[model samples]
Target: MALVLPFEPNEPSIEALVALVKADMERVNATILARTGSDVAMIPEVANHLISSGGKRLRPMLTLACASLSGYRGDGHVKLAASVEFMHTATLLHDDVVDESDMRRGKLAARKLWGNEASVLVGDFLLGQAFKMMVEVGSMTCLDILATAACVIAEGEVMQLAAAKNTATSEDDYLAVIRGKTAELFAAACEVGAVLGQRPKAEQAACRSYGMNLGIAFQLVDDALDYGGSQAKLGKNVGDDFREGKITLPVLLAFRRGDASERAFWQRCLEKGEGNDADLDQAIGLMTRHRAIADTVERARHYGAIAKDALALFPNGQAKDALMEAVDFCLSRAH
Candidate 1:
């Protein structure tokens, strides 16, 4: 079947696709609220602050969408979606604290509002709720998948911490980092849908492939946006990653290709953390000069192509079409 491009009429907007699952999404939202409530007032207060913050809920939305495609007729998908959301939310809460970020989605980060202790505890609470939801589904397949993903995500954060402020990180190391932290959940979210839908192994593998590549592409775009995106889009100041000494693909490529002078520039800014406004500007210029941003976008497009190709196994329909649209949307951020 021919792939449906995002702008094509056959390719529904994210809005229309979300509307298709509106009822299910509502159920997921209710489940999230009920699960987030706690005896300790601080728990709900910190949890809901981040929950209420604006996020597209893309991971859970993917769970619902893939479930629809798999022809799941039970209520399991709703709980699974909620589980996916809680798992994702838990990650975000911990991530902000780890990253020492003060803002999230254009507002003060939950950690900034509440101390790091509350943020960590609330994040732990969310993970507990996520696991409970997984058990409620009584699907061993789902539980194993999500539980493993959570562990890998934690490992990824540790790997990133080890790599931080170290300019010697390779592209392969960077890929491993994103795979564990970001793409693992995406793969689990879609794979669990196939399990719940009872599709054959081949279809489940395809969904997993789609989610994995889509997630890689999504993270790649965010890396690009870190240097190029505005505060409005990124929810944090631009160039935050550089300031944090986090080595991403753009930085990786630029560092590899730079001359002695350019390498020293990266050393001073990223390694020594001695950069100022001019250093950030120079970093961007160096990346541009080395074509790092352009190359990074190219890498993201390659993954996006893989994501679209994974949908080829499934027949052309609204679910498949919307999935393709979502891939296009991920790539569009590069523009």
Candidate 2:
């Protein structure tokens, strides 16, 4: 989603969180830039194409904010934050290849520009760098958290592949796909901060819960936007999910709620891979008729509320306030 937002006078803003972690974020950015360098020319070129693509880098920012809020004074959070970003970047590169996407963050996808082989190999290279940074941090608990997230994210991608183009994919199955693919990394990012702070297990768990819920909300909003938002706002073309036959939450809800004729349309467009530019319009109309996009956004709001609640144990401060606003910032994208 675009980082820019229309003015909402009373809305909570991510600016607070951005200001809160600005210094640490600088360090994380430096680390990311430094790590992208390689003797092989193509590696840095392909990696930097996405790393510098202005995608907001929210995942790494979460790590920094959580660390600051948890009172972590050490520098390990910098390395960990960079690692979180690399993992995310790697996934995006792989995702573009898998989905055969043309655009990302308003530009041609790295896979499209660099070819799938370069994209995948560079993605692997980034994964290696990410793991190296994680190891350098020397926190076993932190390492374990990120390592497990890596594995779970891979499993989630495979799960999504399995569920792709299947109109019968259930809501539970959809949730499982996102939990592993998206939320797992968010959970790990926040939890590792608490680990660095040597906070109590309860606080660590709370951080994980906050990130996990936020990630779910974030993905759900993206799903809604795929059918309901503008291309300029969404970065990628609208109806990308429909064209790719991805079984997202909006499609699942609409498919389950649609009439027999509606079901046939979805089946023909999604399951049978018969969708075209015109089918894209029909798909959006169907989603609107079924309240699919609206309900998907409503579900995001539900998770966003849960994410806010997850931070309840933390004392009220700039850190807490900024983190709270971050959730609002995520939800505000729907508007």
Candidate 3:
């Protein structure tokens, strides 16, 4: 059940982009470790566990990449990148708690390692540290963008909670949720980079658009993979979304395609949150019958293409090329 990409993977441009992202991630983590200090030994342990779990660090890398592409050669980019990563890691810690997830990136979650109390505390600490880093930059604009993004992210989580196991959720509703939970931070990441680079307003807007579209595409692919991906590759069990009664794009599309009885099945599972194996299988059957999975993949690709288009404003260079490669990598990820 490995998640398959729509393309081959031999692009040198993509390779270079990944290398740059990896290098920046190393630097970001080192900076975080230095800042956390030894007094809070548990802080380092928890943070390292999350960091070592092997995420793409795409958000923070976007910050660095966007800054570099804007011709920034200052140390501020490093702090900004680390701030983005911290914010992302904080969200992950909180999300795992909310989702009651046992695994992330194929390892035990922070809450699983420590208690929920520790996880929540450390998550708050990370958030505060992120804000402190923002203050150090002394950019009111950057702080304002991040603060707004954080608020939107929290609201998105609440919206998702309200939508959970509720078949009445519309596509628009879904878009709103992901925009807050996923895209807002991404937008802030790139926007912060542009701000750090002191780019023009139009260029900053373009970077924001790129980040937003990329985030949407990234999350759409993630949701699609829940149904189409291998447990090993996804680092989670197949059908976990259904089991948890989370209504995602595939389920929503399937509901739209279902007959009365099939709709009744959805009601029992998604609306009522009472799904068993039979119901789960029936839901999968209905989704496949209507090509919901394929439709979702196509939609994700559409957004991915939009993300690439947003980068068209920039001239061709290593950083710009790498940004495009990162977009392709998002579309081609098998995990």
Candidate 1 residue-wise lDDT, 1-335, digit = tens: 99977684443247755776889999999999999998889988888888888788888888888888888899999999999999898899999989998788888898888889888889999999998988999999989999999999999889999888777799889999999999999989988988899999999889989999999999999999998988887677889888888889999999999998888888888888898888999999999999999899899999889988997988888888878888888788777
Model 3 clash pairs are: 1-230
For candidate 3, the 10 contiguous residues with the lowest summed lDDT are: 11-20
lDDT of 3 by residue, 209-282 (tens): 99999899888888878877887777777787888889899999998888888888888887777888787777
Let me know the TM-score candidate 3 reaches against the reference structure.
0.92
TM-scores, in order shown? 0.95, 0.96, 0.92
> Among these predicted structures, which one has the highest lDDT?
2
* Tens-place lDDT digits, model 2, residues 181-271: 9999998999998889988999999999999999999999999898878888878888888888888989989999999999999999998
Local lDDT at 35 for model 2: 98
lDDT value, residue 99 of candidate 3: 89
Error of 1 at 108 (Å): 1.0
**Model 1: residues with Cα > 4 Å off, grouped in runs:** 1-13
User: Weakest 10 consecutive residues, lDDT, candidate 2?
Assistant: 5-14
Mark the 10 consecutive residues where model 1 has the least summed lDDT: 8-17
Q: Candidate 1, after superposition: displacement of residue 291 in Å? A: 1.2
